[model samples]
Target: MNAKTTKTAENVTRCLKCRRVLRNASPDGYGPKCRKKVRAAARAEVVAQYKPHQVAKAQELLEQGGLIPLRANRVFLAVSSDGSATYKTHRAACTCPAGIKGLHPCKHRIAAHILLAA
Candidate 1:
């Protein structure tokens, strides 16, 4: 079959990057290898924009489903596994110690960003 032609089984398409026959449908036309590269690039971008600690905290919150919405708009509470709540304001900043010190964006802020992006 020609390179441009789809596979017979369910008319499966090819990967855009490697031009290999795709076994499954991918919205971006990327097969497993290319998809992994794309995901890794996206993750690297996020890591570059945030501190390591903030990223770790955001990941933890996501894993634990710890982000909670508060009464106010653009406001949220990031609850830790230990049941501690850290206030985060999208427009302003978080109330965590790191946020209060203004040294860096806190984990609560990172978690809020991650949750909102999701």
Candidate 2:
């Protein structure tokens, strides 16, 4: 027979709005529903902080990766199957058809930008 370690229900989990319990919690000890809301809020905060700077830096270095600039501020890099292009301030779009369909910039762009930043 296994002996129960003697722990109260409050020590493990807390009641959620819909009665579904959560196994994890916020660092300060939030109940399941509250923990979920807190996690979402934290993720949003992180995205807001890093997205803009990351896009701008990536755009500025597009040329170093053998890309051609389509505009004053845009840069394009070629891939084996397609091409990639981005703007100095926004990397969300590129000239490659794959870009039109929504794909990530490639290693060359990344390396060029990294060198430029250095």
Candidate 3:
């Protein structure tokens, strides 16, 4: 019932899930495959926490150029199709209704992520 251990100059660790010796010192002691599974689980957890409409709205915003960055990435303004400004942000959401309401990531966040990726 005891996990295997590996010793190196840096540290000694064992895989918490599989009880295998870990070559590197991961906080969770997960091997490569287990780390992938952990990441996937975390992603799934985040996806499950969002409402369906939020995801759809983010996708629509990305596709329709609804997000406009003003002043050299210092701020973003997200305009809806109806021509109403729904969100604004510099480093974080400033005046988004969804953000204000504490809902999941609004379109502004998604747009900012896309812009940063570019």
Report the number of the highest-lDDT candidate.
1
- Local distance difference test, each candidate: 0.60, 0.38, 0.56
Candidate 3 positional error at 41, Å = 20
**Model 3 ranges off by over 4 Å:** 1-53
| Whole-structure CA lDDT of model 2 | 0.38
List the candidates ranked by lDDT, beginning with the highest: 1, 3, 2
lDDT of 2 by residue, 1-118 (tens): 3358765557554322222455764333345454355345334433343345554543333322333323432343344323343333224444444444555553334422332222
Ten contiguous residues minimizing lDDT sum, candidate 1: 65-74
Native-to-model Cα distance after best TM-score fit, residue 108 in candidate 2, in Å: 7.4
TM-score, each model? Answer: 0.51, 0.24, 0.46
**Which residue pairs collide, candidate 1?**
none
Per-model RMSD to reference: 11.0, 17.3, 14.8
lDDT of 1 at 89: 48
Q: How many backbone clashes does candidate 2 have?
A: 3
How far is 70's C-alpha from truth in model 1 (Å)?
A: 2.7
